[model samples]
Target: MTEYVALLRGVNVGGVTVRSADLKALFAESGFADARTYLASGNVRFSADGEGRALKTDLERALAERFGYDAWIVLVTLAEMRAALDAFPFDASDEARQPYVVFCADPAVREELLASAEPSDEDPIAPGPGVVYWTPPKGSSVDTAFAKQLAKPRWKAVTTTRNLRTVAKICA
Candidate 1:
């Protein structure tokens, strides 16, 4: 069984809420082993053996059926998750910045993000294997230029982001 993480997008926000326990239960019920949710934000770690696309489809379908919401998740193997953590290129220790990893379900989307933004002290973005590592200033991530680009509706279907701190906890 390979370990996997399902980084659910837009959960616990925008009138959608799923209890952590329920999220874990949904994964286990879907036939994953040791399904554990790191926080109420929908980081579910589990063990299963399947191709990535199949797993993603099954998980998303299960989530939608069980929770009655249009669910989306960035499915990653444990190694991929670790690689994203190790490839973080920003000063995560900076008290004034918020570190984030944006998982791109499509490689094209990742490239587009890299090409769309110019690095700055306020919004620095770097490309990783299948992700975009970002460190936008604390309390201002919502206002950053790169952030505004992400807010566009077109990116919603192919991207989901997680705070690096939360990601570390999930990996831990």
Candidate 2:
């Protein structure tokens, strides 16, 4: 079985509460092995023998059936997750306490987002296959343009973001 990390977007927020235990149970019931949840923010680690997108579709379908809500799910192999973490763009000092990795649904979407990304020098943005690393400027309270851009409805549908530390813990 191949290990995969599933990131659920807009879950456990805005009065929609999906507990980690429940998520794991659903995964286990759906024929996944070693299903585990990393944190309350909808990060799940599990093992199954299937293609990534197909597995993600099944998981999202199950979630929709269970919760009656349309949720977006991003799935990546453990190796992919680890590689993305290792390839973090900025040096340690330049990184924020909550550096974010935005996971795009497909390579085309990734490229589209990256091509239009406008990051300031203080908070640089780096793009890789299926992922983008964004670091916020230190001590800058103002929201970065990248953040605002991602918040737009056009961008929201195609991507999900998680802190690097959270991704590390999920891999761990």
Candidate 3:
């Protein structure tokens, strides 16, 4: 079985509450093995044997059926997740900035986001393999243009962002 990390979006917020135990149980019921929840923010690590997108679709369907919400996720293999963590281009040590890896499920949507959000000196958005690297000023992430754009409903289905530290924590 291939290990994968399912980065679920918009959970434990906006009235949607999915507990870690319930998430793990659902993964177990769905035939995934060694499932573990990283945090309350919907990051799940599990093992399964299937193609990436197909597995993601099945997981999303299962999630919606069980949790009763419009489920969205960016599923990546453990190797891919580790590579993304190692390839983080920004200074994660900077307390003044917040480093983020925005995982985009669709290439077209990723291109559209890059086209729309103009990156500046302080707030830079760089494209990586199947992800976008963004480092916005600390405490101003929600106020940045790229962050605001990501918060739009149009991108919700195609993208999800996690902090660099959080990503490393899970990989660890």
Candidate 4:
């Protein structure tokens, strides 16, 4: 029973909600032990068998069947979690800076999206096998043209973002 962190997209956000307690119960009913939910943006930690992708598919299916909506699940194993934590390029103590881990489903990096963003002094790093870390320039994240450009593509790619602190807590 390996520990896994499952990140669900588009659930319990903007009032289209599902209670974390109910979500945990659903996982429990699906044969997952040690089911727990983190701060309600659809973060769930559980123990399961086999590869992360297979586990992700199962969890997504279970949630969609039980809740009647598509749950985009991204599964990260314990080792993967540790690697993502280590891969963060920015200092976690710096509250002013936003450190993000963008989990990509495709093995190949999306060159098109990467090319669209303007180059910054702060280099984006990938500490894990399939994770990308970026610290957007101050005040640039909200007003930048890149935000709108990246948002749609990122959503289409089934990517999930988590702050460095949250990532650390999940791994811890």
lDDT of 4: 0.71
lDDT score at residue 165, model 4, on the 0-100 scale = 73
> How would you encode candidate 3's per-residue C-alpha lDDT over 66-132 as one tens digit per residue?
9999999999888888988888888889889999999888678778888888799878989877789
Task: Report the Cα lDDT for candidate 2.
Answer: 0.83
Worst 10 residues of 3 by lDDT: 104-113
- lDDT of each candidate versus the true structure: 0.88, 0.83, 0.91, 0.71
What TM-score do all the candidates reach, one by one? 0.96, 0.92, 0.96, 0.83
TM-score of 1: 0.96
lDDT of 2 by residue, 1-172 (tens): 8999888988988887898888999998999999989879999888899898789889899998987788788888888889888899777454453477898888898888888878777668888657998887655423778877787778755788987889889878
**What is the TM-score ranking, best to worst?**
3, 1, 2, 4
Q: Which digits, one per residue and each the tens of the lDDT, describe model 4 over residues 13-131?
A: 65558789999999888888898888878888889877776777888888888888867876777677788788666776665566777766644543444555564555443334567
Residue 123's lDDT in candidate 3 = 82
lDDT of 1 by residue, 1-172 (tens): 8999998989999989999988888887788999888878889989999898899998889989998999888888888988999889888899988899999887898998788877786688889989999888889878989999888887886789999988888888
Off by over 4 Å in 4: 109-116, 122-128, 137-142
- The lDDT leader among the candidates is 3
- Residue pairs that clash (backbone atoms under 3 angstroms), model 1: none
Clashes of each: 0, 0, 0, 0
